[model samples]
Target chain A: MAIEVRIPTILRSYTGGAKVVEGSGDTLNDLLTDLDSRHAGLRGRLVTEAGALHRFVNVYVNDEDVRFLGALDAKLSDGDSVTILPAVAGGAFGFAAAAAIAQHNTAAGRRTPVTVG
Target chain B: MLSIDRSIVDAIVAHARRDHPDEACGVVAGPVGSDQPTRHIPMDNAARSMTFYEFDSMEQLRVWREMDDRDEEPIVIYHSHTATEAYPSRTDVSFAGEPGAHYLLVSTREPDTEEIRSFRIVDGVVTEEPVRILDAGVDPHAVQSYMFGQSPATVDYECSGR
Candidate 1:
């Protein structure tokens, strides 16, 4: 059950700059546990304290996304390859100001100020 | 290096222009293990933001499953930068999971100028590469390796009309 797990650049520090590492487990979660034992704190970045996979992390087994399979419980075996990547978010620009202004204008046009009845 | 048809490149740029003011993202799938990108798939940007792009989770699943059924894989993943240069941002590199895929960026910041670039993102490293746009009657397989000192694609590309 020696599976090859590819490490992402941001998380390679835990793996000592190793791009790929070998682990043994029947399930994906188990594989992470096996890897954490050797790598130390590798699993924390991928999984949350509540035991769920971290929201910003994506795990794939053999190129098939684990979320579509069974997430952390996805089955695994020897020769399977696991890849972990962080969720990409954020950039420049703002839609909030325009959206708020539009909403305000629409409200002002749709209703008139009424005195207390 | 990656070789793509001129028509395909045009289609990608067109999509970027059509989605101006909002980021666009999609993929070009090829036969599994072939590494020849041919199929064009324009996907909706889940974020719908000018500065960011995200593949809708459900749409991503459906597209991936469809590709799997067709014995294909995403050989090229593309996105648009509405106001930025055609380069992968830190977020893009952080999310790159396909080591064998070519990452393409198209910038539609200028109305008259569209800057398209290709990159290889593996393990968070972004390396720009030459994109050979094949003209009519020029086979991607037969095109001369115009990229100086760059290795040719591993698989030969045939006209696999969709």
Candidate 2:
């Protein structure tokens, strides 16, 4: 079962700058494992140490997000197109800082921290 | 350095202003390997939070696929900071995944003046870069300070309310 995977710009290095690469597998995990064989360290970026999909990495089987389709356990078939995209997210403050500030503000009985102008 | 059109910068600033309490995010796509930013695609902030911004997953997929089909890449990834300075915060540094694209930040903290800055974030390292905004229809090589010197009588581009 050959599946075509689209690589994002950030992960292109692992695929030798190729935009698309092919791999084989019956499930998403197996597909990543198959890809890791050819693209060393690629799986590490997509999957965390606990074997779960990285929080900031988004994987889609065709047009559907894999998270909605059993994530890493999602089934795969021949000619399936898998696309990997890094979740584009960030905030004005670090999580710890934001939490601390919120706690301090709450203790002071002040309104929530002003985030916007 | 991120050399982009002045109109595009205005559009970004306008979008940021319109979404004052919430951060606005978007991407500028250009031909592959060409650093020039030509298309401005304003994206929905899925988080819809005052301090954070995230591109909607489904919308991101569609936009990314469109860029891929057009043989283009995200040359500039921009977002607004509602109450902070126009600089990458620790959160931004940690979550930056587009090493090849310019990370443009617009600050709407001040009602009178908006601050804009650009940076290159790679491997958790943030390096500030100079932004050269080129005037529409003007030669890019010409040294014209459209942003600082004076405002154009008429804007050639319209900011889409996407």
Candidate 3:
């Protein structure tokens, strides 16, 4: 199973100037876990501790957003392409609302008058 | 991932271009079930001429939610272009939150030669979706409304909890 994953602009430094990388795996988690083992801080950057994907970083499997799907557990194909999109900060008020929503949603409690964008 | 009517797009652009050198805003109403989409939602920008956009307030959200309860999910977001076209700017791309909604932009340079465009932005990339102006049918009254401070209804979310 061979696949190509595109690196987002924010995390390019971790991959040492390589915008694209190659990996092989039957499952999305296996591939991402392998990528993290090879690239120091990638996994931590992409997934949260409870296994939910970060909104700041969008991972697309063959142009399909993982957020709308099964996230990291989403299956992959041999020739599928993975695109990593990072939240850009050049624009003012970048991802603060989405990040806040994500942080608040995962806190494990009732609505609590949770603030959302 | 969604499609909306052109007439609604025109209404959104109309309200936005009226703000001319300032910012305008509105909410989009649609069928209440999941995936319901809107062409545009009218809004009032607190920043005014500053042209900055922040979140909507609780009271405002409450009003829209009430309307939404009567209707469907508020699926589209409309904003103005103070000095430019109906295109996405760097700031617009960054502050995008409702990935599930459509973005409508109206250029204010020449209301007569109005422009409208829809977009879906994720992360930092802005993807333009096709949108056309409809029976907006030449309204001198709307033109006059634009000059006055009569902006579309707005919900102030930035100062909601703070």
Taking candidate 2, what TM-score does its chain B reach relative to the real chain B? 0.84
DockQ, Cα level, model 2: 0.40
Query: Which candidate should be chosen as best, given lDDT against the real structure?
Result: 2
What does the lDDT read for residue B109 in candidate 2?
Answer: 80
Tell how far residue A102 is off in model 1, in angstroms.
17
Compute the DockQ of candidate 3.
Answer: 0.05
Candidate DockQ values, in order, are 0.12, 0.40, 0.05
Native-referenced TM-scores of chain A, all candidate models: 0.75, 0.79, 0.71
lDDT of 3 by residue, A1-117 (tens): 589998754577779979789887776788888888889888887878887776456677775667556877888888998877643211122235534544565685433232111
Residue lDDT tens for model 2, B56-121: 889999999998889888999999999988888888887899899999998878776777888899
- Point to the candidate with the largest DockQ: 2
Residue B106, model 1: lDDT of 81
Q: Write the per-residue lDDT of candidate 3 for residues B18-135, one digit (tens) a residue.
A: 5555556765666655444442445545333324544333324444446545655556676766556567776677556556566666656553555556687765677776543334
**Per-residue alpha-carbon lDDT of candidate 1 for residues A1-117, written as tens digits (9 for 90 to 100):** 589987765688899989789999999999999999999999998998999887566678876778888898999989998877644332333334433543675778743232111
Error of 1 at A1 (Å): 17
What is the alpha-carbon lDDT for the whole of candidate 3? 0.57
TM-score of 3: 0.45
Question: Which candidate do you rate higher for DockQ, 2 or 3?
Answer: 2
Give the poorly placed runs of model 1, Cα more than 4 Å off. Answer: A1-45, A48-52, A55-117, B137-162
